[model samples]
Target: METKIFAKDQIDEAVALLREGELVAFPTETVYGLGAIATKEESVKNVYKAKGRPSDNPLIVTVSDEKMVERYAKSVPDRAKKLIKHFWPGPLTILLFVKEGSLPTAVTGGLKTVAFRCPDDKLTHDLIAKLGYPIVGPSANTSTKPSPTTAQHVYHDLRGKIAGIIDGGETRVGLESTIVDLSVETPIVLRPGEITPEEISEVLGEEVLINTGKVSDKEIPKAPGMKYRHYAPSAPVVVVDDVNDFAKIDFNDHIGVMALEDELDKIDLPKANKFNLGRNLVDADHNLFSGLRYFDDKKDITQIYVQGFNEGQASLAYMNRLNKAAGGHHF
Candidate 1:
């Protein structure tokens, strides 16, 4: 299959491919998502085949608007309405009880609940609206790899397998949406992203639980990135908790270092060997996957050393992704 790259204005082209049950990658504020018509079992299955994603792991249903979610979900609760009002069209995913037979089993991973999100990107919103249905959108990269923040990154991991990619430029959030499971009695955060738990709690006017425990491999995860080793690259990654620890690393072998600009400057390494994580936490979140991909491209890089941040409301999302990518290997 010849994978074409569509410009941002080419929503019609991308919609046409999706209409034909062809898998197309679309941009979101969070990350690029590999899209398949949510109603079509075959098309959704093809997404798993293309990305080498496990069938047991569920896919997120990406919609154009809040109303689109009402079509597939059984019923929207009052709490969900609060969240949708504040966080819709942004990096927030909500898990609600699915309408029976409304979506394919492939989309829900045979579970009664389905994850839904209305991406903030105009091009993707237009694409979903034009199609008049939801699309099953997981991060547009091979399973367990860093999520694709750019169209070119999607092409690198899933070039010939998919039909085409809608190039909407680099994603703004550079991470997946914050997934909250509303199907339960009390809402729990299944995955952390740009949206913090505190922010969600503020909107809902109640405390939200963050599920920090690991999901065993034998059990199916309610959200993406819960059960799998996600956002990792080919090289071994070690997390450095403190900026001063950079001096402690043995630089004898070929190594790639990723940190904030100030942290990078503190280390004694060549510019060519260092990948900057930008100036602050937001910049670090935006540049995390790109930095991982940057080092993965260099043939000489054997191991990667990434700076870790103190866990807090602001830094939780970044640390979640970094710890997973590093596999908890600390310096």
Candidate 2:
């Protein structure tokens, strides 16, 4: 099925579908979001069904600005406000307590709070402004699948499932937004994305707590994509402790190596697929999924090997996605 492209001219129709409790994939700086009206429980369920996402994993609502966030959430912490001033309209999402029954319970997964962000794109901003309602939006992909960076990726993952897709070309960040929970006095990093925790601290003057372990089955989360196995591919991928460690392992022919510039030239394996993630982590972050998609597409690749980076601001988000994709397949 051919995917419909909705530009600014056709935004009215998109808004109409949303108002009618229909699903639509729209652009954001981080990625395309498959959205449904947050107040409409039945409509919000369609987002989960369309992407095959789990009901327990809550959805983030996309708004126009901080003022709009106030409508759904009860209070925005001072730290949250500071962070918003620094990263709003970008790849950062703040989690706060919701007004009692302000939004549908489905949007919060029966939790007391919700995640909200004011998108940066002109089309998205205008759509949110015109709709006058919050939209439950998660990355436009199936559960455990790589997040879509381009409109084609969205169509590839959710073409017939959604009513429409706004093709705003490729996303700028090429990753999901940085999710921080401010419901407590101190902020916690529920999910790392393009924005770093250090950057958040610099703006708020407080340390950020990052959640790494899997959440318990009984526990509830305020933000979306918190505990899911995200950005995974069909092929089995592994992340080694380092490039030198990868050299110790031997595979006959169906192996691929993804690495940085320092390790790229050092490792020499014959007739094996190899991808250089660039000299630094920034380029690696941008190209990581594209490289995985390329390798996953190849019929000959049985397993892909990766080299892990040191823990730091530049490597945090990139490593988070890589580690999830690897799932302890590392050598």
Candidate 3:
């Protein structure tokens, strides 16, 4: 029930805690993850409870390397193998045909497929490798809130609810891993991240479909950040095609606008507190979640207006997070 930062030298103790079925919030290259040994159902349950996540909302398991993939996945198709060869130990997560009894039901959410990634973080890889099993760790934050990119965010949301955090400092990508579904014949990208669809297609030497359609009510979430309002801050975010139009509105609550660097001069909201997203789309991706959380901390701001970025191969992940946070609404 106690919460504190664990130094790098303490990974062995963290591994011991995981092996004993306790949850440990740790860093990954993409984001901080609340981890537990994939084989332990009770451990996975604690993870779900800590994040206030639904049991049916599956968890992505982290492995040390591609060699450990087969231990959890039943069939790694040619496409998956090519993807692993190209993007493993990085930000890509591939959903595969889960090996029978390879993982507990809690990890897979009763689905026949399982999503797994080999993170680029040394501490995370060492923890997984030392434990001798895959560890199921989703973003270490409360469900539907901004996904924590730093250990401080984890400590804020999950301090007294679970175990200690292994502060590996800030995550590099600052977004969750790109998730691809390989269970079917043609791979479909379930969630966009740093690894774009074009990159995946180039790696496999074939076109991969990007599933950008609306998720229906009856559909189950194949990955995290889907099937829920996610990456949201305490303030409600509204996406607008142009920030100039927002100048026309008169609202009672304090207004906050996230303005793109190039278009900052065009925005005419005199009273709005503006946050700049750099001209480079990559920088926008880097600052997206943290920017949202920044606005959330502005106590008087109830409505946050975000300048929408056109979704493309490079900007897919940034747009995806914004779309979910605003429920795909464009004002």
Candidate whose lDDT is highest: 1
Candidate that scores best on TM-score: 1
lDDT for model 1, on a 0 to 1 scale? 0.91
Q: Candidate 1 regions off by >4 Å?
A: none
List clashing residue pairs in candidate 3: none
lDDT string, candidate 1, 1-331, tens digits: 9999999778899999999999999999999999999999999999999999999999999998879999999999999999999998899999999999999889898899999999999999899989999999999999888889999999999989999999999999887889999999888999888898999999998889999898787888888888888888889999999888888888844899999898787777788899998989899999999998898888788899999998587888888888899998999
lDDT (CA) per prediction: 0.91, 0.81, 0.84
Model 2 Cα lDDT, one tens digit per residue, 81-115: 88888888888988888989888877888888888
lDDT of 2 at 244: 71
Q: How far is candidate 3 from the true structure (C-alpha RMSD, Å)?
A: 2.1
Clashes of 1: 0
Higher-ranked by TM-score: 2 or 3: 3
TM-score, candidate number 1: 0.98
The 10 consecutive residues of candidate 3 with the worst lDDT sum are 263-272
Pitting candidate 2 against candidate 3, the one with the higher lDDT is 3
